[model samples]
Target: MAPVSNNVVGIDDDQRFALMKFRRSVRDVLKPEHNDHFLLRWLRARQWNPEAAEKMLRDSMKWREKWGVDTTLATWTPPSVLEQHFPSGSTGFDKEGSPLIIVPFVGLDVWGLLHSVTRTDIIRLVLVHLENYLTLARKQAQTHGPTALKVTVLFDLEGFSMRQYAWKPAAEMVFTMLQIYEANYPEILKICYIVNAPKVFSLAFNVIKKFMHEYTISKIRIYGSDSKKWQAQVLTMVDKDQLPQHYGGSMVDENGDPRCSSIVKPGGKVPKKYYARNMQNEAKKEYTKVTVKTGDKHCVDLLCADGDSVLRWEFGVEGHDIKFSIKRRDQDGNETVVHEPRKVSEGPPDVGVLSVSGPATYSVIFDNKNSFLRSKKVYYDVIISVPERDLNMSDEPEDLEAASAVAAS
Candidate 1:
């Protein structure tokens, strides 16, 4: 057979860069006699046909359009984004000098979901074969100082419900890996998470607060969205004292000797304001409840609140009429505030609604006086209110025919 063309295939730009570097590193080790066999074997292992390798290379040019695998160079930046969020200092570094290794703890289902949604081959690349490559990179970085060390993690949220997907494992994995990295590689400035979310950002703050006990690193920072509000909230909680005190040590009344009174004297009232503020803050913790009707006319009721403050109240209707409103009440149980109602024409059925049962009522409460002031309780009630029309479960032939026609063509 004739000599194979210099063209290569079955690789993305990042892969190609890695391949080129690999080729260069082994150039001296691979004598001319070994070059063709080694290269051919590597290509074959990747499922490239020896006879069709040239065709694949030529085809790769069109693959950019047909497969949407553009080889455009990615803009390179310092991995500071990861570092800023997950700073891995010099504690976990191996004696031989390698970047800390991070393994994600996401469920397989989440992995599959992300794979299907993203369809990025590099995702498969990392999931399947990046560990070995990362090890090599870490070794190289160690020998060359921080320039060679790199850290990265992957996240998938499939196992979690849509609501739970907001955070949990992703945030936990990123925070844990950062902690490990910081301990092992103090000189290494950053680490990276492959995906991002608001909850993950919040989790990072939680981790920072926890870390504060042992390390005095700067507060964790997040970019994008109303991050400042979240950061401020988290920091304020972290900085506040969360300890309870016994006030007005057992006092003696004028008539008694060593009287242990139930009430403390004047000094006891000093902490009352703080206690009330804490209680009010706890009462303000938010909760949600939902109600739905399924039939010719679909309607949904949502109730959400924090303490006496109603965060959300809305009734959504299907088809011609959809409306929602929210109201808040004061301590006296009177409606002190009302919000403008929003109305919109009905469109498609909400999958979120279909997945859940009807007439749901959700509530959340916080214990304002808890030493550790997190939301204390969350409650949910779902009531299904099926319409009378739905009880007569017979498909009309005309309706079925129309639906089939719409589905078919």
Candidate 2:
């Protein structure tokens, strides 16, 4: 027996509708290879709920637009900041053809690295890697039948501390990253092992896990870190030669040298020249203050008159975190969010900037929806600027004010 429908062979009505909506919204970015298998990954992540799955897919597409992520996939290079701070990489494939990516946190310069890059860059870097992972997964799936569009994450948490995960900004970033992963990337992580976790590392993760969805939380395993038990389980998944020597695995090549070229050893110094330029965006900035209590909200509306204009923002919090978004209202009095919801940050930390695709009222939302007992105090500022341009219509120019309006249509 077999299922049959206009939908993929396995998906139902709701899942099919979700896929249809995604194609309609971002048809330009779609490649022929983004077939049912890709759709199934998003469908399964939301447990086949059409509405939830559609929103996740939409948000992800909008995010891709603002970040120029689609173009990044083809031509983007990893920023040096990522290479210097984040000691993570894909080593090799497992028996099932799933890629294995390892992140060694022991003695890593997490604090220095966290401050070195803005939240957006961090997200961008992670997404780039994920995009790369998907590329490999798709190729492997062709050779080997049926595969989950996900990767195995091995988080080596040895010697992690308050200085690393305890920082409010860093913790918030991790939480936001988790939210993005669960809502958009969904089910993309095949499995995760928090190996070599020091007891204190639990303190930091306890707070971070609160933001993770139940489905994702279920896939995580905190095993015997830095012990025989950890190595045993890791070896079962990855060959010893695929691992680094310091972790009791072999990286030695046939000539008695390092064999694995993909592995990245933990730790590196970001040169002084790049540090200041990297931190310049995050340096001292002014902010406006407002309070939003539970079920309450504070919104900042920035109006742009032309497409290609930029809306940039920066903010900080006093007591609790707030949800942030960029939204525009359609003619039917409906709101379509323009940027993926900000899952982390007091606000951009450095600056959150998006180039307007059309003239519209871009709303910056400070939602305290998750807070219960207290009001969140947020200090922020936004700048909307545009370059002058003529529509180049007729000998006489049309009103410049019509720039954004014309673009919106």
Candidate 3:
């Protein structure tokens, strides 16, 4: 018999039998019950020609290598490399052309007593206000370009010793901001915190460093008091230089020698373990007692007095509120109706919005008329709600189920 050309061939009886056997073997290996029907069809469609089938299999393997096939598929495209599909100034833009704003609030004192509030609780409040601020910022930016506004929070540490709760609340706030920023706004340029003590700044910067490392954030700048310069520099150093080394681990040659040769051995600086231990010890110190004559007295005292007084007052009864809510536009075109209202008061100068995520309208309502209360106090209220049905996750069950099944397989 004449040899068949590579492009065109007639299947002889022997060839046909071999092809049938191959199909049977493939089918047996990939049981229909175990494999998807579409996958089976795909396999069968490529079985007619051996070269085409081999090419298809090689292509599929390459695809699997390129895209991955794990249960929870993760395709990591670096931010710098990824296509900027959306137009410039699309989402997450402030009026002043900043990407997004994350305001971290420790408490109301800036040096006052540590309130009897949990770090988690404070973070929740900050998140609520942040959402409202972002909603307002986004609308304002869209309508009137960008505007410059710093989201400030009073970190009172009076009655509470700085050693006790300084880093804890600050760390929590930074972590929460990181989570919200990662989930919603990847383009956030700056995060500002109106902090009191140098230690609190250090603690918050440590948390920020952690997130910066995890997310590969290259540039981070902090502006605070001179006392915090050391802490800020530490954060910048850890973030810009050390974190990558830690995560990547010591690179070793085939013989296991460290890849980078150093003339001077690195040691003698304040180690993280020791630093953490010291912070914990400081936190355990006894706080000075402060007289809270009225709700506003603590605030006034902290702001007016020296640094020592401010730190002491934070631990005292300085009223502060942290709230979380979605800002939504009502039918009448006004941003109102914040979901889940929570109030925490420690004197006046309300701790405004901390961080916001997702899409919604937010409004900062000041109690202009103190009709009910005789004292002239400023408190902030937030309104948050979803704008469209598409944004709601109620109808994603079927897709979720399919994905879950695929994942299990």
Candidate 4:
């Protein structure tokens, strides 16, 4: 069998030449850290088509400049958002030497916090961690090679609820993170291990799964909701010494109890002391509402002139399934599927961005026509928002204060 290059089966002389040309085109933009391993990720993201990869790389460069990603890496950190809204910790390394983040999901009040603060700030908080994550990952890669240059997320889901799992706003955040992380920060998640998840979690997870690529979905390993069942598996992936004692490891505090004893003591909310002080003054995000009653259909139309143009959308359903489809309609009224029809659910963010090929009316349809007695309603916002179109930073980062807060805490 022939080997695959960027998921493409055949890579001939022309393709190789094209790849070299593409990399050369972005020579000035390449930082010292932008090595073959780094360039290869963008290539794989575009399936090794040099033209597509080149376009992606150009757009990403423009985006990085606009967002001041390097600047953010040097200066930004949202302490209140981290400590109050979403509490998380950077623990020890994984078996591959990648940095590990132990997220005690059972403790977070996902819906409550989304209601309290702007979802935008929540995302910024994640960016703070992502910035730090890369620094740690680079150090790990120095020891274990580039393959170790990713973060492993072990979701401690002991007390996760369907309420938190299926909540629409939280779902929206998940989708937003999925889009941003996948496009801008490709090939970064080494693996995500989820443990002690209840059966009901699957329903919400099925919705969450829609936002993930098959390659990404494959990296996730669920250890069941049973502690005994996952303890062995967790122990195998991480050294017992580094493992949090809550998961049955040797990490202990001064009292000789689990290191995460308070944080992981079943379900609890982040305390008032840590809640964002200026949350009320923060600008909130906006969303468009879409309603679909029984036996009715709705479709959004966009005119795509060229393949260079990107199309993006984000939406959440109100606890019901809506049939979603993206198709291209031609002059003769012939419709061809761009994205196939799937039953869109009430959780996770249903979002996608792709470069369109043919010029025509691209329609995003939501069909509730099949349901006899039930009606579905969804809140959504669609943006044919292309990459790097507007090169501007809209908000100021709380830099020094955030750093001080983290250090002091």
Task: List where candidate 3 sits over 4 angstroms from the true fold.
Answer: 1-121, 146-162, 166-177, 190-204, 213-220, 223-409
lDDT: which candidate is best?
4
Q: Model 3, range 369-395, lDDT digits (tens) per residue? A: 222333333322222221121122211
- Each candidate: RMSD to true structure? 24.2, 14.3, 25.0, 10.5
Q: Please, what are the lDDT tens digits per residue for candidate 1 over residues 130-179?
A: 33434454455534443344432212121222332222232233334344
Best by TM-score: 4
- Show how many residue pairs clash in every candidate, following the order shown: 24, 3, 64, 1
lDDT of 1: 0.30
For model 4, the superposed segments whose C-alpha errors exceed 4 Å read 1-21, 77-82, 165-167, 259-409
Task: Answer with 1 or 4, whichever has the higher TM-score.
Answer: 4
Q: Could you tell me the lDDT of residue 289 within candidate 4? A: 77
The per-model lDDT (C-alpha) reads 0.30, 0.63, 0.32, 0.67
Over 267-312, each residue of candidate 4 has an lDDT whose tens digit, in order, gives 3565555554454764454767777889998888888765445555
**If the candidates were sorted by their lDDT against the true structure, best first, what order would they fall in?**
4, 2, 3, 1
Question: What local lDDT does model 3 show for residue 3?
Answer: 17
